[model samples]
Target: MKTSPRLESALKKLYTAFHSNKLNPECNKHCAVGNILDNTDIWKHLSDHHGSIKLNYIGTVHQRIGRKFNGYSPLELLEIEATFLKACGYQLPLHYKNTKPKNPTDKIILFKGLSDVIRILCEMDGIDNVMDYTKLFEVKNQKAFYDIV
Candidate 1:
């Protein structure tokens, strides 16, 4: 899958933001690896204030607010992804989805969606590899992370 330049730049910026020691004044003294995992208060603060929440590919943003709603269709996912790409300053190719080969050889053609976006975020943050994390968003046993490879 071809990634947009804007997405690449965003990934790089997120990587630097997460790994730069200078950004966290007390990182060495107080914030250890285990602290991030074990501390509930710290985790809550990160989720609530740090924009750490991830979007769902299957569900719209409103569904994230605990409202019962149907998941996005494949075409809707494409539209949403295009919006995200534009927001990140990238112009996606015209008829991007239609450009795919008519006779595809791959048995499992993974559709890039919001899950892929979160995977990129996780990768940039050095939190977890795609395999360890992407399973959480998998539907019907189709692994999004594995599909990337």
Candidate 2:
């Protein structure tokens, strides 16, 4: 159950942001990757457009050099952002006229986005999805298998 230090740190920050109502998909400084990167907008420069998986010149250089920002590569960061945006109901390559959620700050909306990002994070760390609870519904020998503790 060991987690990477970088992943642990990012999860801690993201958890804090979620509960503090700081997670906002429309704001660069409050978005998923932004929170993981300490609410900094620097990661935005890694891509030419928001919600895009394509890396820019700087992002490509960093990825090619094997640089890690807050434990994620430049491309990984972009994927995280794109994943979050998509889960939040944003149109790809986010634009002012692009379709988006009616309420970007809604708890339900944010939760969905957070869930997807967490799955991606776990994948990046080669771990099981922490948010997955399907195991609780397992059935064994025609009996419900559950863990009470």
Which structure among the candidates has the greatest lDDT? 2
Maximum-TM-score candidate: 2
Judge candidate 2 at residue 144 and give its lDDT. 73
After best superposition, candidate 2 residue 147: deviation in angstroms? 2.0
TM-score of model 2 relative to the true fold? 0.95
TM-scores, all candidates, are 0.21, 0.95
Among all windows of ten consecutive residues in candidate 2, which has the lowest summed lDDT? 140-149
* Deviation from native of the Cα of residue 24 in model 1, angstroms: 7.0
Per-model clash counts, in order, read 0, 0
Alpha carbon lDDT of each predicted model: 0.32, 0.93
